[model samples]
Target: MSDVLAADSATIGEPAVNISIFGVFVLITLVITFRASRNNKSAADYYAAGRNISGQQNGLAIAGDYLSAASFLGIAGAIAVYGYDGFLYSIGFLVAWLVALLLVAELMRNTARFTMADVLAFRMRQRPVRMAAAISTLAVSLFYLLAQMAGAGGLVTLLLGVSGEAAQAVVVTVVGALMIFYVLVGGMRGTTYVQIIKASLLIVGAFVMTVWVLGKYGFNLSSLIGGAQDLAVEGRDVAAPGAQYGATGTSKLDFVSLGLALVLGTAGLPHVLMRFYTVPTAKDARRSVVWAIWLIGIFYLFSLIIGYGAGALVGPERILAAPGAVNAAAPLLAFELGGTVLLGIIAGVAFATILAVVAGLTITASASFAHDVYASVIKKGQVTGNGEVRVARITAVVIGAVSIGLGILALQAGINIAFLVALAFAVAASANLPTILYTLFWRNFTTQGALWSIYGGLIACVTLIIFSPVVSGAPVNPVTGVSPSLIQDVDFSWFPLNNPGLVSIPLSFFLGWLGSKLSKERPDELKSAELEVRAFTGIGAEKAVAH
Candidate 1:
C-alpha cells in the first residue's frame, strides 16, 4: 500500500498523450445515445428497446456485454505470466455460453416480459419471487459493474500518465456519468447500439493484434509455439495447467468449483438474461446466442496470440511496475506493437467495452428495481408509461453512483477486481441459477421452493465468500509483507477455496427440493404445463409492440 502510494506520488505530473483518440469514441457514443432517446417513447422502449433488436445486432451486443476487462486484459495477462493455465479462463467463459444457449436463451425469451424475475415469478407467488429475484439481479450487476469501474480507474492511469486515487476516482465518475447517460437517454436501444459498435471494434482489434504478433516472428508456427511457452512455471510444465488451476496448495475440488461457477453462472447473469427480452421472439433470442457463440469463440482464440506475444515480447517486470499489471499486459502489448497511437485506440475500445457493459448492467439493475420491485410488486402493476421509465432512469443513476463509490474503495483497499468478478460469478451461479432451472423445468416446483432457492443461495454465497481465503485472510502478500485480505489481522478462513460454487450451488438446489417437499405445496399444474408449452414452443410469448 505504501509502495503504491509512493509510486502514485512520485509519478505525479508526468505528461500524457496530448491528443487521445478516445475522445472520438466518447463523442460518437453520445451522439448515438441522443439519437436513440428520440425513439424511446414508452416503458417498453426504455427497458427492452420495444423488443425490436435484430439477432445480428443483439449478438454483437451480447458479446460486448460479456467481454469485459477480464477478457481483454486479465486472461491475456494470466497467460503471459502463468503459461497454459490462463487459457482455461477463456474456455470457462466460452463454454458457459453453451449452457446459456441450451437452457436459457430461448426459454427466458419465451417466459419473461422484461427481467429474470418475470420468468421466476411466472407461475409462482409474484411478490416474494420478484423480490428475491430482484435482489440477486442487483447483487450480480453491482458486483460486475464495480469491477469494470475499477478497471476503468487503472486504464485512465495508463492512458493519461496519471496515477493515484484521485485520478482513478475522476475516471470512475466520468465513466459512471457516461453509463448513466446511456441508460437514461438511449435506454436499451442506445445501450445495444453502443454494445454492437464496441463488439465490432473489439473483434477487429483482437484480430489485428493477433496478425501483428504472428508477423512479428515472420509468421512462423514453430517460432510462435516455442516462444509462447517463454514464461517459466516451476514444478509444472509451461504448456500444461498447474500455475493456477490445481496448483500447489490448491485443491482439484476448487478447480471443479470454479468451472461449475463459470459454466452455470452465465445462464443466470441478469444482464445477459435481460438481453433475451430485447429481442422480438424466441427464435431471435436463440439465433443471437448462436451468433455470440461464434463471435466470442473466435475472439477468444486471438487471446492466445496476444497473451503469448506479451510473454515473448513485453515481459512481466514492466507489467507489474504498474498498480494492477494483470490488466496492463494487453494494453502494453498494444503499445509495444503499434506504439502510443495504437495503444490509444485499444484503450478507446476498452473504454467502450466498459461503457457498454456497465450500461447493460446498470439498466438491468434499474429494471429489476423498477419493473420487478416497484412496478409489479410494490404498485401491483399500477405504474405504467412514463412513470415506470422515470423510476428506471432514477434507479440507473443510483446504481452507477454506488458502483463508482465502491470501485474507488475497492481500488484503495488493493482488492483484485478480477477475483471480485469470479466471486460474482459464484454468487450468480448459486443464488440465481437454481431458481431459474427449477422454475423452468420442474413440475412440482412451488413458490416456496423458488424463494428458498433464491434467498438461501444468496445467503450461502455471501457467507462462504466472507469466510473464504480471498477475503478473511491469506498467508502473505508479496509486496505488503502483511496479509492483505479484508480482515488482515485474522487467519479465519476455514474454507480453502476462493470460489464458493461447489458448496453453494448444490445447497441451493437441495433447499429448493427440500422446501417443496416439506411444505407439500404444489405449483399450478396447469400453469407449469403451460410454461413448458410457452417456453419451448412459444405458444403465447410476449411480442414486440408496434413502435
Candidate 2:
C-alpha cells in the first residue's frame, strides 16, 4: 500500500498552473449557470427549457450526458489492463447508441411533457402511473449519480495528491454546488450550453491523443498488435491475446449477457431520454440522433486506438497496480509525447467533462423529483411554471447533498469503480426501459400494469445485486480470498447475471403484460393509447389536459 501511494504521487506531482486553471474553469461554469436562470419562468422552462432547444445543440448535450466518467476513465483503464477484450466494452457502448436512435429518441420527443411520467400517464389515471414512473426515474438516476460521484472522488484524489477521503469530499461539495447553481439559474439553457462545450472539448482531446499515438507507431496496426502479442507471450499463462485480456475464451454466454445489457441499456437511460424533449420537432430529434451517432462513433474509434496505445507503450503492469489512479492515462500519454503544456490542456478537458455530466444529472434528478413527484403527483398539478422552477432549485440542493454523502462513503469503503457504473446501467435498463416500451407500444397497458412493472423490476434488481457474488466479496475461491462463497452459508446463489438487466428486464415486460391482463377491462384504455401513438408521431398535437 505504501508503494502504491508513492507511485501514484510520483505520477501526479503538483503543478501550480494546472490546479489554478481547473479552479478558474469551475468558477466560469458557476457564472454561466447563474446567468442561465434569468430566462427560466415556469416549470417547463426549468425542466425542459420551454422545449425550445435546437436539434444540434440538444444532440451535443446528449453526447455530454451519455459520456460519463465510466466512458472516459473506466473504459481506457479497462483496455490498458485487459487488452482487446476491454475494447469490446467500447464497441458495446457505441452500438447501444443505435438502439436509442431506432427505438427511443423521436418517440420520446413526441410523447411526454417534461418527464417520462408525463408520457406513461397520458393513457392512464395520473396518480399511480406518475408515482411509479417517478420512483423508477429517481432510482435509476440516483444509482447512476452515485457512480459518477465515486469516479469524481477517485479522479480528484489522484490528480491533487490528497488523501482519498478529502478528495471525495471536495469533489462532492464542488460539483454539488455547481450543479445546484446550474439548475437554479440557467435551468436547461445553462445546462445545454455547458454540455455542448464539454462534449466538443472531450472529442477534440481524444482525437489529439489518438493521432499522436498512431503517428508514433507509424500508423502500423499490425505492428502495434504484434507488440502487444509479444508481451502476452512472456506472461505467466502464455495465452492468446484475447484470452490474456479476460475475454472469457470460448464461453459465449458471458459475452451475450454483456452485450444484452450494454445494447438495451442505452435506450433506457432517463437522462438521455429527457434530452430529446429539448428539440423542437420529431424530425429535428431524428436529425440530432444521427449527429450524435456520428460524433460518438468517432470518439469510440479513438478510444480503441488510445487503449492499444496504452497497452503497447505504457504497458499493463503499470496500469493495474493503481487502477483508480490511472484515470490520467490519456493526459499522461500527452505529456510523454508532447510535454507539460499539452498535458495541462488534457487535464482541463477532463475536469470540464466531469462538471458537464454531473450538472446534467443534477438537473435531470431535480426535474424528476420536482416536476414529476412534487407538482404533478403531490400537488395534483396546481403548481405553475415559476413555482415549479423554485421547487426544482430546492430539490437540486437536496440531491446534490445526497450525492456528496454517497461520494464520501464510497471512498471510505474502497468500492470497485467499474462495477459500480455497470450496476447503474443494469438498474436503469431493468426498472425503467420495460415500462417505457410497453406504455408506448401496448394499448392494453393499464396504470396498474406500469406500477407493477416498476416495483417488480426494482425489487428484483436491487435484491439480486445485494446477494451477487461480486458485491458480497466472494469470487471463485482462487481469484478472491473466500474459500466458500459467502452466500453459501446463508442460502442462495444470487441471480445469474452480474447485471440484473439480463434477468429483470424480461421480468418487467412479463409483469406488465400479466398485470394488464388480470385487471378489469377498461375499454377506454385502448382508445387513449391510439391517441398517444398519433400525438407522438406528430399526426396530432395533444391538448393540455387538466391535472
Candidate 3:
C-alpha cells in the first residue's frame, strides 16, 4: 500500500499534452451541443429530438451511450487483472442487447412517447403506475451514474497527474458540471450528436490500440495470450477461467447472479429504452438496434485484445500500484506502447466516453421525473410542452449534483466500475423487467402488479445489496490491509453472495404474478386492446400520447 501511494504520484501523462488534448475535445463537444440546442423549441425536441434522428445516426448514438466507462476503463482493467472471468462482462453485455432487439425495442418505440412510464401507464391507472415507474427509472439511472462518475474521477486524475481523494472529488464535480451543461443546453439532440462523435472516437481509438498491441506479438493472438500468461503473477493464468471469480461455491453463485442481471437488465434500462423513442418509427428502432449490435460487437472484440495486451505489456503489479488502481490499466498500457502522445489521445477519448454516457443518463432520469412524475401526475396533464422542458432542466441539475457526491464516495470505496455497473443491472432487472414483460405480453396484467413488482423488487434487491459482502463483509486484501467492501472495517453482511440478481429477479417475477392474481381492480379493456394493437402493428403510433 505504501508503494502504491508512492507510485501514484508518478506522471501518467505529460501534463501539457494531456490537458491540451482533453481541452480540445471538451471544446469541440460543447460547440456541437450549443449548435444542436438551437432547435429545442418544444418538449418533443428536448426529450426525443423531435423523433427526427435517422436510424443509423441513432444507432451510433446508442453505441456511444451504451459503451460507457465500464466498457473501456473498468472491463479492460478487470481483464488485465482477472483474465477470462473479466471477459464475461463483455459477453453478458453484448448478448443482453438481443433481449432489447427482440422483445422491447420496436414495441416501445411504437407505444410510448417520452419515457418508459408512458408505456407502463398506457392501460393501467395512470398516476400510480407512472409514479412507480418513474421511481424505478431514477433508481437505475443513479446507480449507473455512480459508475460513470467514478470512472471520470479516476481517468481525469491520472491524465492530469494528480493524486489524492480531494483531487478526484474535484475531477468528479467538473465532470458532473459538464454533463449538466450537455443535457440542459443540448437536450436529446445535442446529447445524441455528442454520443455519435464519441462513439466514433472510442471505436477508432480501441481499434488502433488493438492493432498496435497485436503487431507486437507478430499479429498472433496465441503468442499474445502466451506472453500475457508468462507475465502473470506466479500461479496465475490469464488464459484460464478462475483468476477472479472461481475460487469458491459462493463466488460461482455470484457469477451466476451477475450473468442473470446483465442478460435481462439491458431491456429494462430506462436510458437505453428511452433511446428507442429518438428514432422516427418502429422500423427505424429495429434498424438502430441492428446497427448498434454490429458496432458494439466489433468493439468488444477489440476489447478482448486490448485487455490481454495490457496484462502482457503493462503487467498486473504496475496496474495494481497505479493511482486509480485497476482502472489505470489501459492508460498505463498506452503510455508503455507510445509514450506521452498516445497516452494523451487515449485519455482524451476516455474522458469523452465518460461525458457522453453520463449526459445520456442525466437526461433519462430527469425526463422520467419531469415528464412522468411532474407533468403527468403532479400537473395532471395540464402543463405545456415548454413548461415540462423547464422542469426537466431543473431536474437535470439536481441529479447531477447528487451523482457527484455519490461518485466521490464510490471512488473512496475502490470498487471496480464494471462490478458497480453489474449491480445497477441487477436493480434494473429486479425492479423493471418483469413488470415490463407482463405489461406487454399479458392482457390480465393490472396496475397492482406493476406496483408490486417495481416497489417490491426494488426494495428487496436494495436490501440484499446493503447486507451483501459487497457492502460490508468482504475479506481484506492482504497487500492493502483493507476490506474491499464499500463500508469497510465492519462485517455486517448477511447475504453470502456478492450479487442479489439470482434471488431478487425470481422474487420480482413471482410478485408480479401474485399481485395481478390478487388484485380485483380490473384493467380497462379498450386501452389494453389499443396497446396490444399499437405495440404489434404500429397502428396509430404517431399520436401515441394523445390520450
Listed in order, each prediction's TM-score against the native is 0.93, 0.89, 0.97
Give the TM-score ranking, best first. Answer: 3, 1, 2
lDDT of 2 by residue, 93-164 (tens): 789888888878888887636888877777788888777777787777777777677666666555554554
Point out where model 2 deviates above 4 Å: 1-9, 164-167, 228-252, 323-328, 409-418, 474-496, 523-530, 542-547
What TM-score does candidate 3 get on C-alpha atoms?
0.97
Which scores higher on TM-score, 2 or 3? 3
Candidate 1, residue 160: how far the Cα is off, in Å: 1.0
Q: What is the per-residue lDDT of model 3 for residues 149-226, given as tens digits with 9 covering 90 to 100?
A: 888888887887776777778878988898888888999999999999999999999999999999999999999989
Error of 3 at 186 (Å): 0.7
Best by TM-score: 3
The count of residue-pair clashes in candidate 1 stands at: 0
CA RMSD per model (angstroms): 3.0, 3.9, 2.1
As for candidate 1, its clashing pairs are none
Q: Please provide, for model 1 over 59-178, each residue's C-alpha lDDT reduced to its tens digit, 9 standing for 90 to 100.
A: 999999988777887778777766677777789989999999999899988874888888888888899999999999998888898778877766666766655767667766876787
Q: What is the lDDT of candidate 1?
A: 0.80
Is 1 or 3 the stronger prediction by TM-score? 3
- State which candidate has the highest lDDT: 3
